[model samples]
Target: MENTIFSLIPPFLAIIMVVLTRRVLLSLGVGIVSASLLLANFSLTGTVSIIYDAVKGIFVSEGSLNTSNIYILLFLIILGIITSFITISGGSRAFGEWAITRVKSRVGAQIVTIFLGIIIFIDDYFNALAVGQISRPITDRQKVSRAKLAYLIDSTSAPICVVSPVSSWGASIIALIGTILATHNITEYSAFSAFIQIVPMNLYVWATLAMVFIVALRNIEIGPMKIHERRAVKEGLVSDPNKPAVDKLQEDLPTSKKGSVGDLVWPIIALIVGVVGTMFWTGIVGSEGNVSLLAVFENTDVNTSLIIGGLLGLAVTIGFFIRQVLVYKSVDKSVFKKGVWAGTKSMLPAVYILLFAWTIADLIGRLETGKYLAGVVEIINLNHSFLPLILFVIACVMAFSTGTSWGSFGILLPIAGDIAAATDISLLLPALAAVLAGAVFGDHCSPISDTTILSATGAGCNLIDHVMTQLPYAVISALIACFGFLVIGFTGSTTLALLTIVVLLILFVIITSRRTKEV
Candidate 1:
């Protein structure tokens, strides 16, 4: 009992700090440090040697910097630089101006922005920053609250990316599925094949997107978000005093020739075309007698797909800069440098968040407790005839604590899959869905989650504010998902369960909105 309690103390203390103080970095640091100290307690050595071994073990045997993780960070950095360049070149401003002209009302602007976010579908990081920057001015002009704008951008980012087949997210999911198949000794399942099979079962991603549309179109209100929306409507446009005065300088300049919409549209198109064409050329697409895309993805030492995508985005952004310069006939080298510098600066926070999350995740992996945790989960027979709602809750908690959906899936799936093998339950779909949904739930809500932080930063809301405001909505949806999973677990009809949840959520939102108005 003492050992068990001691083993659990670090994660518990971390949560307490996060909730009480809302300092994500501090919480993560404390958890990692405490875990390291606990690990040192087991080793018989001098203080320095014990500390050295703990830190070394973290990045070596446990969570060493692998090619895959390196690639993810590389993609993030390159994408950040490209996004920064686009913003500096006046592309975002041009897009904002064009969007404002088309959107006559606040609701229309919000809906259109969400639609645009759906269409991007290249990468979540790209989608978040580009959409937020392009739509911020337009939404502000329409008297829409920054909180609402942030919510829309955040909602659309991960959900859309997870579902789309041609994205960085898609690539990651494919890799994970491949690992699953290999571990199961299944030779017939390919990444693309598995992806197609799992797509329909990804209820959480689809459900979240559906909710965003319902809220935007029907003007639904719930929790803190509803309060923020009401305040925005009643107070009109409350100018952010914290915004730098340099922002005002852009107001007086004549709109660029490409326009804000043009700025946003062209670069996105280039990125899509480049990624698709490159993937096809490299045999990622099914072609006759050619190497399989999966083979290429696996064999390549670098994350070639993301590298290719980033390079393409960069080229298109450069073209936009040239076009602006030539059209205005007042371009200089300094202008280009300024754009690049601005883009890089905007991405700094995202870079910091990613690095910290990566380090913390690595630290967690080092603890022998992680393996013990996995063993405990397996021993519980959680996959066998368990209550779906309880399983959902457990999955969420595990994913949240670990800060990784893929890792959580790896741990849970085999155990869950074994249960499926033994019972009447069709383990493939439900188990996979549970893993995906739980990971997304944790990813969406956890303050230390890189994706969550990016969403907040991209939306330009205070980090804590975004986390606090978004929590209620995420929880409501998760509860709905939990109940839906229960229904599916009993009936084994996921489609029916999903449809039922959608309809009920829609009705609930409508009733809630009406009640708030009456009050």
Candidate 2:
């Protein structure tokens, strides 16, 4: 089954089960077991060994600690603690009350969340969690559903990073492009220049961003998202009460009446500073003294930076927590232990989901799923003009199946370059751009995607609910982007493609608005 059509079964099974059952962990477990069985040829003992090795690999790879995964998990735990402390200190409550006076409308709240997500484009992980902590209070106060907030965060994080030259995503993609360019002996453009050129050609990023803004500004709601939004507005039920949320706090925690917005604002600011500072330090140290901007980004240790920053944020939050109990005397000192336990417990759901997700993703890699998809792309004898569109679709399937955009990029970008170079070197950048766009599009829609998981965690939304609610919007954006890629493929005119996106989005928003009002 490895590296063949059978390699596709595990992911499809996981996706189908999750959609039908809305049970994330159970579905992932089934996928994991099925994948292990396939790899082991249905031998129970061999399957056990494969599963054990895959699980072990998540924490221990190449006889060393998998610091990337460990650090990200640690960051989530620390972030959950900080969120709990913020609430217990009354920072969330105070901030929401404060913002209600200023924001005044649900649309204003959602727009603020959208803009914050766009502005924090350094890394998707940081963007998703940090933006949620900052914007959740205001959005909740305005009765905006957690699902919508998760959608906003997920939509902006990847799309912005994919396009921005300064982001981690850009650095990774540029490095890949550099290798691809070198392999093809294409000397007309540098990787940095190619990345810039490819930016406009990434029509999905544009289409997604357009839809994000239009949805915020026009109050457009579609599919499951509409149901969520309607419930939030009419009943003030921002989340499904029966569902478990990664960011859900314990009930009846003691809150300090004296807590101010500064308690919340300062900790988050410290977090950002600490994270960006650590990124620079790690980048410079790794660069061996040649610390150019792109070089810094390329060499930066993202997971390590996240944990260091998370620690700083946690420290500040603890300080505020102590102040609430010790100084203000509004919160009981006895609540300290419960607060800590509550915070840790809140994040366990997300952690368990991530662990399973990582395990299955690793097992899927062992199945050579991406390699099979890339092979399919390479063997297709399509027209040169259709290369971008074809690569986009293949990348979507590959990333969706593997549940990782970077994995798709690692496997597909080089193949795309090879195909485009042999057929039409001029289409190389567009083709690569299409891969980037499609990978993100797939990541957005995949329930098993880490970014998708973290987005729901950060927003305090149900995981499956976030996946289902955001699917319709992601599909619409992808369809528009598909058309854009087709236009760019044949006409090689980004302006024309962008114009089409704008016109289509306008029609979509108008149509959605009328339908929403009628409902």
For 1-519, candidate 1 gives per-residue lDDT tens digits of 122436656666676788788676688677766766666664445434644654454345555655545555555555555555555556666666666788888789888779878987766655775676567767877877666776788778877776666665666667776676676666666867877776666666776777778777777766666656766778774234453211122222233444455666677677656655665555444334556554443333224555676678778878776776777554455566555555555555555556656665655555533344545544564445353444456567666676665566566656555545455446555766676677677777777666676666656665655666677777777877876777777777868778868876877787777796797
Q: How many backbone clashes does every candidate have?
A: 6, 0
In order, the Cα lDDT scores of the candidates are: 0.63, 0.91
Q: Considering every candidate listed, which one attains the maximal TM-score?
A: 2
lDDT of 1: 0.63
The TM-score of predicted model 2 comes to: 0.98
Q: For candidate 1, report its TM-score.
A: 0.79
TM-score of each: 0.79, 0.98
